[model samples]
Target: MPVQTRVVYQVNPSMVNALKTIREQAYNASRGVINQRVRIQTVDGQIYEGVVVNVDRRHVYLTVPAMQGYGRQWDEDLILTLVLYELLVITLLYI
Candidate 1:
């Protein structure tokens, strides 16, 4: 059997924040989320999954289905806005 090793780097808080800010700016400028399905995990461990309807420098708006009874349906007026700093991971989903 092959041995496995893991290494971790302890980054300074300021550096981590700076990296995240830079990443956010790049992502916003690219508009990578627009029209693409994405699943986001927030810092609080909350998960949001849906298609991106709109995006801005500070927030990303997602078009998610509203649950009615046991079924899910689209609601044009309903939108979920998530702040950039709160996002821990955003995975783009391709169908």
Candidate 2:
């Protein structure tokens, strides 16, 4: 039997900086884009896809995608960076 290999994805630092800008602009613009779909790239190279639930000057709250056979779950991971509209926004949240 052949074993299947899972490829791990890594997020770039420059991308993180761009995402931060969108986040800030979104905050400043007070746009309804809040709670929008977001892909977060952690410093650990873990890629997380979730929704932006809440945001502040310090951190961003994302309701991580649901797990198998689990009640409503969520995680507050640091926003190292993001790619919104093809723009990369890197935040210090990862650090």
Candidate 3:
């Protein structure tokens, strides 16, 4: 058997800058809808409806209503942390 060699490639600077710009846009858009009810769809087709609580460089935090009757003593809302790049759609909810 012959020896195998591994090659490593560096990412292009232009592509990095483009991705950074896209991320910044996404963050700004998400920040605009903070504290508002919205529905978010991921690239994998999973959907989540919640209020936009906060956003960071790489993730958006949402506060979703938790289901009742699980024999818990305290009541609290569920917080979902989704990746920014994985989000496909974000729609404002009226109700």
Candidate 4:
């Protein structure tokens, strides 16, 4: 029986810079839509519609409408923290 050894490789500096640039672009795009109603679709096919509340390097926060049912009043809004890289599309909703 032969034992297998794990090999780890170091990331290239250029690749790291490229990834940083991409992340910054994504952050800026998300920031542009802050306080505006929009629909976001994730890579996993989950759709979320809400106003962009906040954004960071790795996540976009949205304040979505809460589901109402059971004769209960939903006062608080639902906030969703979605991963930035996982977002596929963002559409602005015209009022």
Candidate 5:
């Protein structure tokens, strides 16, 4: 017998709207509900997946559970370059 493997791809933004909508409908919504799953590709074309824990109109903040090369959570100073997913939606913070 031979081993077999298959791969599946998902467009990360597909869930962004839903997450935003949920946040909008919640009474206790805070800046944190902006969290969403995003797919990021590095300069070398490697892919990574994690939560977009924060977002602004121009950029996204990712809490990546994994990092390549270092193979673990990176130090605070080194995290800036590893993720590159653009924010797909904008939500206002509760007043």
Candidate 6:
């Protein structure tokens, strides 16, 4: 069987300049979308599309999709928590 893979990014919370644009976007998007759909690409080359479940000062939590037949139960490993600074772009269609 082929091994499954998922890209994850980790960085510091003080990524002000680096993540400034994204932070603002996240804030605006959160109020508008609030668990609606989102598309995010990161420096690590991960492409994710999911609901914007939560957003904090330095991280955004996307409810992991069942792309590989995984059930709805999401453990920590399943959640795609993108570090704000490491994200290249985040697009929310419904926002």
Model 3 residue 77 CA deviation in Å: 0.9
Per-residue lDDT of candidate 4, residues 13-75 (tens digit) = 778887677667778889999999999998899999999999998999999887776687678
What does candidate 1's lDDT look like per residue over 7-94, in tens digits?
6877787798787776577457428768888888888999978888887777888877665544655555468988877777888988
lDDT (Cα atoms) of all candidates against the true structure: 0.75, 0.51, 0.88, 0.88, 0.46, 0.71
**Top lDDT prediction, candidate number:** 4
Taking the tens digit of each residue's C-alpha lDDT, what string does model 6 give over 1-95? 99998769756768755568767665565546557787888889988888888877777788865555445554343567777666666777664
TM-score result, candidate 2: 0.38
Q: Which of 3 and 4 is ahead in lDDT? A: 4
Q: Identify the candidate with maximal TM-score.
A: 3
Quote each prediction's TM-score: 0.62, 0.38, 0.72, 0.70, 0.32, 0.55
Error of 5 at 83 (Å): 8.7
**Across residues 9-93, which tens digit of lDDT does each residue of candidate 3 receive?**
8788779887777778778889999999999998899999999999999989999887655486436898999888778789999
* 73 Cα displacement, candidate 3 (Å): 12
Stronger candidate by TM-score (2 vs 6): 6
Q: What lDDT does model 3 reach?
A: 0.88
Query: What ordering of candidates by TM-score runs from best to worst?
Result: 3, 4, 1, 6, 2, 5
Candidate 3's TM-score reads 0.72
What candidate 6 gets wrong by more than 4 Å, as runs, is 1-32, 69-77
Better of 1 and 3 by lDDT: 3
Q: Tell me the lDDT of model 5 at 62.
A: 53
Worst 10 residues of 2 by lDDT: 86-95
Q: Which is better, 2 or 5, measured by lDDT?
A: 2
By lDDT, the better pick of 1 and 5 is: 1
Residue 6 of model 6, lDDT score: 78
